[model samples]
Target: MATRTIIVPEGMEFIRDELGYAPAVRVEQRLYIAGQIGRGSDRQLVADKEAQFTQVFENLRQVLEAAGAGFEHLVEVTSYLTDMRDLPLYMQVRDRYMAGCYPAWTAIGAASLCGAPGYFLEVKAIAELD
Candidate 1:
């Protein structure tokens, strides 16, 4: 197997602009994704927290699929939050995506995020796939 870095510049400019990393990387059959946020296809942060968390997972799903993988392949995840108080809501939406398979996870409480207000949470994932 070979390692690869995938940059979806056609739709995601913030990868280089904000994080200075490619959108995703494949290494030895695993995909280590950069941090994904609650942004839409239009690249704007959804104003609602539940919607934002939903969008973030959707965005991560897209990246995983782009790398030929799926949610069950995720082995680890790192989550950041501008407001830890929103974790319940975040987890509600997150559980819907995770389907009871809990990956190794780390969460940090933060003062703010890169985008607009109400942008409560951000998360990145590492996936093992074929």
Candidate 2:
């Protein structure tokens, strides 16, 4: 079997040193990005929910770009939210980023997110390479 893997960038050592995981991975025809929160490059959560969501997708965009993929290539999305009330906002954000095609998706409420008070969202994506 052959595999293609993407290692985290330098200074994102937490993904490996702390979390013991890669941020994204590609095997054959699929790219899987790990659940991402609203935290910015500076490691601080965006001040607002909608803004955070935007930043999150932008961050995911970078990850996908690194894997030579795009939102249109996505086939599935799984989102976890700390509050159900944020679902609409989440969908709106998703629409903003996803544009025309809709991928198979599921967004569910969670009791908490990675032990954070302000964070209310985490999203993962699976995209097809062919």
Candidate 3:
């Protein structure tokens, strides 16, 4: 049986302690990352669209790094947005972090996220580890 390991990067314990969920889980060579939002380490959400998208990616990066992986290892990604109009900016910010490593991506329009109105974006991903 493949061992399941919960990944929680340093300084991100709030995800498990408060949120009651692991940021990512690793089973063998596959890592499944939970939806990351624009919240900072202090648990405050970034309000600006561009900045929020960046923060969300940063959070994902932390999770990936904790699993000894990077954006290049991502095989699939799913993004949730409160407004479909924000797609362009989201793609732009995402590309900045993803560089040229394009992964299978799906974007979905959401009415709300994190049980709040200001939370505009969330991202989840799957990665293949070395």
Worst 10 residues of 3 by lDDT: 40-49
Would you estimate the TM-scores of all the predictions? 0.86, 0.89, 0.97
Residue range 38-90, candidate 2, lDDT tens digits: 88888788979889889888878877777778899999999998888888888
Please identify which of the two predictions, 2 or 3, would achieve the higher TM-score against the true structure: 3
Q: What's the best-to-worst order under TM-score? A: 3, 2, 1
Question: Which candidate gets the maximum lDDT versus the true structure?
Answer: 3
In Å, residue 130's CA in model 3 sits off its true spot by: 0.4
lDDT of 3 at 129: 97
lDDT of 3 at 55: 96
The Cα local distance difference test for each model comes to 0.82, 0.83, 0.94
What pairs collide in candidate 3? none
List RMSD in Å for every model shown. 2.5, 1.8, 0.7
Q: Write the per-residue lDDT of candidate 1 for residues 1-130, one digit (tens) a residue.
A: 4757664534676676776778887777778898888889887779877888899989888888777777899999999999788878878888888987779999899888875566788888889887
- Residue 8 Cα positional deviation in candidate 2, in Å, after optimal superposition: 3.2
The Cα RMSD in angstroms, rounded to one decimal, for candidate 2 relative to the true structure is: 1.8
List candidate 2 stretches off by more than 4 Å: 7-13
| Model 3 TM-score (2 dp) | 0.97
Q: Give candidate 1's total backbone clashes.
A: 0
